[model samples]
Target: MINISQCYSTGTIKGVSKVGGLIGFCSNTTITDCYSIGNLEESPGWENAGYAREYLFRYFGGLIGTTSLGVITNCYSCGKVADVPYAGYTQYEYHGFMGPSEYGDENTVASLYFDVSKAGRTDNFAVAKSTQEMKQQNTFIGWDFIGIWRIGGGVNEGYPYLLFSYTPSEGLNVFIITDIGLKQVTEMYLITDMGLKKASQSNIIADTGLK
Candidate 1:
């Protein structure tokens, strides 16, 4: 069994058949303390977008797709899980927590929650909670608060973050430029114990010595 914990996804993942926001397919797996803040769309491609037709089976889950011989605990998804509006003979098996749990004897999923307003379905597969409930710590039972995770203060905004990123001192400053390319001839400033150092790199990874 595969054990997954303290992981999250914030980007859109689109696909069909055993598709999920966290894992596309799962069997004999155990997932805990995970979340997805991205949209999970099934059959994203257009019917006539160079393809003949969409897949006949579209099984999608907010956190995990088709679960068989698996266990999911203390996981949540705040993303939309549904099939795109496409005119075709496409089948859908979408769920808030997981796609149809086929083998009830082998698969066990508990404490799975989703945003009621965001997620369209409120089936027994996963519990539905309000947006306010998601932000509160008490809402999630058996979650690690001291060692593994922390919340608030714009880290994950209202969500919890991994403890490795926690800092008691001043936080590190990060800046990004979308237009910049590798070896594009640009200057950079780095902070060192000595002082602010101005340097440039022929390659992004190579050091150019302190100045």
Candidate 2:
């Protein structure tokens, strides 16, 4: 029952096996309008690499390690995929965006894409595009631009950014405006699924000089 809507990752993810930029392992879930652009690296210092590969399941991807029995749409990933280069004990699987699944493939995903330049590999798991193509808005079709996503305007380094993109660790959506002279931030708003709520004064993260 895992459902992730309009979420994204802009950092790094490290793990031994079943590692992913967004989700490690998922099933029967629905992920839409999501993406990840973080370097995925293998974490050393564990049991035997071979032994662990069987136990941990050597599966890595840019968005999800493995998934099935679900739907994914309008999702993309642009990150470097890394894993145990010499796991001879067992076989390791890696993909630009996703790995194995119970009953799904490229058909199960609509408008799913991955950046070949960044991920360093391309597979049939998802659509592969160049770095420059990824930055273009036209590359992402059948996506909600006005409501869910925004690109350009110096947003996310030309990458598509969710209109309300914010992880739980980032507190909440605290946008800056010019109404307050653009010199300081004295306001904050809590964006909920229902709608935007005028957050209380306590929601203000900071009210000081901007520059």
Candidate 3:
């Protein structure tokens, strides 16, 4: 069992059974405050256990292929899920957030969300919302915006960005005047195309000190 949180994926994932954009299979694990923004391209099935012909099995999701005694909460996926066509098979199965919940009781998963307009899937386990709705901060009921996440301001293409990706630089000096004493904090400087800039947790302010 493991706990994963405050992360996201922006790459493609491809496989057969137990295929997903983020994690193929999860067992007794807890995933929270994560999302997948890449595409899930799964190939047609693989060789069956004993049969010579290739066949596709259950379990394929945009976020997770299968959940076995696991919990996923406050997580969402906005990736398109599709399967490559197989010559012999006519039926293809796919999902938006998760393929199937093979184990766990009723409280295993909670507050899972997905973008219906982006992922192009609707499943019972996920609450679907439009692209615009996903961009809004209020769409996520229990998410922390002040400390753990950020919206807009040229990050994640309007999607929520984890605070880990928005850490304040440790090179710039900030002078703070207090009743007790004065404090100066060093901040990291970021050289961008615009010019030298000071990066903070909320925004990046241009220094404009050099041409």
Candidate 4:
């Protein structure tokens, strides 16, 4: 399966529809300890102007637009979701955590949270936390602080961050989402312009330039 671990997205992510701050769409993958502080908003001057707002899906999400057969855990997002116009569209839905899943099941979504104050709204897939509560360590009850994540100490406005992003070690790794002509499979191989390579070999290669 595709493994996305300890990843995050920042800044504003604007689009016509189905916009996700971290991932626009994914399926059958495992995402853990990830977050998105980026804002999700509908692109200006691009709504229903000669186009039908009746598109099958019109959504904006903090982490993912739609994920099916996926497992998400220990993830959170504190992003603003706004400027979407879908007054009469039945499929119009937005969320601070997720847009939708193929099976419409929330079982695969676990340990997920969102800052309602920043997001302005939320969904059933994730729990809502106020801005103040999001900054407190006690708010994340079962999160790992000693290893994968850390909070406070003037970091991320006290929001949790991946530990390896701050500390230098052999464990530091960064996985770039493949853009291999839009076709992807739930496999361990990363096929890029540099040629095919195993996911394990990619993960073990240190990013020594991190500072």
Using all chains and alpha carbons, the TM-scores for the candidates as numbered come to: 0.68, 0.70, 0.69, 0.72
Name the runs in model 2 displaced over 4 angstroms. Answer: 47-52, 87-92, 102-107, 166-211
Clashes per candidate (backbone, < 3 Å) = 0, 0, 7, 0
- Provide C-alpha RMSD values for all models, in order: 10.7, 9.9, 8.8, 14.1
* Candidate 4 weakest lDDT stretch, 10 residues: 177-186
Q: Lowest lDDT 10-mer window, candidate 2? A: 177-186
lDDT of candidate 1 over 141-165, digit per residue (tens): 7676666655544555466556665
lDDT of 4 by residue, 1-211 (tens): 8999989988898876677889887778899999999888777777445676555336678888778788989999999876556645423477887887745655486788999899887676889999888876677768876677767545566677877776323332333333211111223445567877555433534322232
Better structure of 3 and 4 per TM-score: 4
Q: TM-score winner between 1 and 3, please give it.
A: 3
**Model 1 quality (TM-score):** 0.68
User: What is residue 48's positional error in candidate 1, in angstroms?
Assistant: 5.2
Backbone steric clashes in candidate 1, count: 0
| Rank by TM-score (best first) | 4, 2, 3, 1
